[model samples]
Target: MQDPRMEDELVIASSPTDDGISCWDLHTGAEHLRYKLCSSPPHGLASVAGRFLASSQLRNPKSSASGTILYWSWNKPQPEVKSFPAEAIKPLVSNSQGTYLAGGGVSGDIYFWEVATGKLLKKWHAHYRAITCLVFNDDQSLLISGAEDGCVRVWSLFLIFDEVRRAEAKHLFEYSFNEHSLRVTDVKTGYGGCNAIIVSASEDRTCKVWSLSRGNLLKNIVFPSIIDAISLDPGEHVFYAGGRDGKIYIAGLSAPGASNSSYGNHIIGSMSEHSKAITCLASSADGFLLVSGSEDGMIRVWDTRTRNITRIFRHTKGPINNVLVIRQLQNTSPRTSNHTLASPLRRHGAPLPSPLEKFVNSADENAYVKVFINPHTTSNQHLDSSYITVQTMENQIKELQQQGSSAAAEVDVERLKSEQQRSLQMIQQWKTMYDNLHQFCVDELLDPSHPGISSGQPM
Candidate 1:
């Protein structure tokens, strides 16, 4: 649906939290959409408008599975959004109007595209290593990018536009920083907090705030673990940073003095809800409220001012790889609505399950990644496709029996029904006896780390 107030609504990309994307209708408390990228793990996502969303998949281009960019048009339900092969363009950011998109991929090649025309606009061999993240300023004039080579480069997109028209270089700002023993994960520009200030994060367990004005280093906020993801807050007082240790760190930002290590920021507590790493985080427009997503597939909304968790959402099944908070609507029904990114309806403040239970549940929920479970052999399992087939066959046999066929035909139907009934009986027996099958698999994978999994029984 088109936004009535011209503010784009929320189209959350969910998967098992394991891989791919399932778009949830925030209004319905249900996931009515899925975007299955062929063979690659999806990395980043941004919904520019009501119906248009772009995603980045990370995989080897030469391998059987290649990294590709996907464009989704919801005019058709989310499932059919054809992902065109974009082996070269690993997406990073789309422009304000969603007309232009920017991303860099293998070979540190930075690129942008005109979304409607699908034409390559500005292109450059931007880095030596693969590009990690890219973002355009709110004005769409400057593009900030980070690469695995431990360098952050800023490009003047408008200047490039002029060069396209008049052939000149419009370079804006560029900086190189040491990953200091880790890979750079992401870079973001602070538009509201400081002029020409760009923030970059790396696996070095630190988030750095750079002063783009004088081409100088500023402050370094040492984080607890390898920084997995970092997002700049609106109103710029603080920025949210999370690590692989499953904690959300609120690093307060300040105008730095001449010193690079000038203790300019404070750690404004953290939201440590997940058992594993936090993969994604975003903030509301005011910076007073923020949300974080993790490999545990949970979302927690935090009140930055009070340092308290407002609401915790456990809507996704597997790992949540990407999260973006767009501030188009305010006080938009505290409830999940079609037009917003509010928290999903769930029993709040339920004493968090014991840490062990959380870990065990995470293991079970994510076991489908490589270990396939058979519902016919396990308790509290999803109905396998075979169960559907069996049920369908049994229903057909019953229908034939009720048709009042001849004696020979009835006998045949009765034989088929007897077989199905026997199968169902056996299945029920196993289901009751093997209720611990899922728990056993989860325990092996998560805690004890099984060397090999085996049902060890004939199907």
Candidate 2:
């Protein structure tokens, strides 16, 4: 029997030069479906829970039109849905649950939308210059962004949704790291929730690791060339940096022996296979394999342990910029002899989400509502239901208080009081019924009129 893990490994790669998006099997190097008419910028391609593929289009240098976002179904060659943003969006990211999608505009603003409703939920200034990269933390509660201003900021989604808390806080960002001198190219988060470490690469030819818990830089390693992308190892022992000099530099994390390496401190080694600048890097589910895309229009899968190229895929039309390793979708693959075409609705099962809005609706300023649901799964997933309810109600109450709407608060209090009274009345009714039943039984037993009791059968 073949291993499911090996069969499910897939590699998706795209370029900025109108080469569309190319996908291939990670193990066998066989090509899958090729999506067309997509010219994506760096950090623009995303897979929404393997349901569909989305990419932010690269705007023409002289075009004054709004930014375009395209979505393609797995079985379709062309994009099925399109969205126009207020500005040219460069980088896009989605949460793990696929409930929200975030994009960074060229105007240095971040636009957030609810995926299901396609409503623009939040828009705020995130950077001084064009935003470059955006990534979510391990738990999806926080978002980290990097930009041309050489700044990286962490944002809490909970606070972003709570208007009252946002107004009360001194700053919107939870933590801001302004250590990089040049434009930040990429940012990645480690495994821990609050204690996770962040690795950010920059055009200044350096990579800095920051500790989230301490909100400080932990290690900084200067590279031989500017790093455009980075991939953290699954085990958190090391991370790979893709440099403009066409080399994948391996830097140590928790592992030792970095001080003795010839490349420099904390620099363990390097992998050289691409002929041109390395554009992006991604690691496999297991830490043994590393995949890299390059300006030479080639994708190479390297055996990290042996430092040898295991497989190579060529994207001949343009320079490969974005690469992702995801689970293979059955319907996305080529049709076999027994396969038949499915209807559009049947292919996705659910209707496509509406087009994302360009701006927030001013008329309905208080229309935003957030609901958190716990998915029913077989795995051990623990959630504090009461705590979540309390937190949500507290935020709503705070917002009401800030609005100076005492009438709304009083109405809610009265409604809750009425509910409490009804509950107490129902409890009293149950107690009265129990007492009446007890008295009837006692009377029947003493009067010896009940057939079942047998008038003191013990005597």
336-382: candidate 2 lDDT, tens digit per residue: 42223232233445556778888886756644566443221222222
Candidate number achieving the greatest lDDT relative to the actual structure:
2
The number of clashing residue pairs in model 2 is 0
The residue-by-residue lDDT of candidate 1 on 1-459, one tens digit each, is 444543333435443223555544322334444555522232357664322456655555554236556555433333233333334445457665545556676667766654443445456677778777787755556677777777777665534545354354344344455544565787777763225678888877778878766666677778768887887877777787888988777677764433232322466556676788887777655566667777787776777777687666664367776766543223322434543344211212111111001011243543311111112121222112221222345557667778865754766778899879889999998997787897876676664334443443332
Alpha carbon lDDT of each predicted model: 0.57, 0.82
Q: What is the lDDT of residue 310 in candidate 1?
A: 69
What shift in Å separates residue 216 of candidate 1 from its native position after superposition?
1.5
Worst 10 residues of 2 by lDDT: 376-385
lDDT of 1: 0.57
Question: What is the alpha-carbon lDDT for the whole of candidate 2?
Answer: 0.82
RMSD of each: 27.9, 16.1
Question: Model 2, stretches more than 4 Å misplaced?
Answer: 5-7, 62-65, 255-258, 329-350, 371-459
Q: How much is the lDDT of residue 28 in candidate 2?
A: 68
TM-score of each: 0.61, 0.78
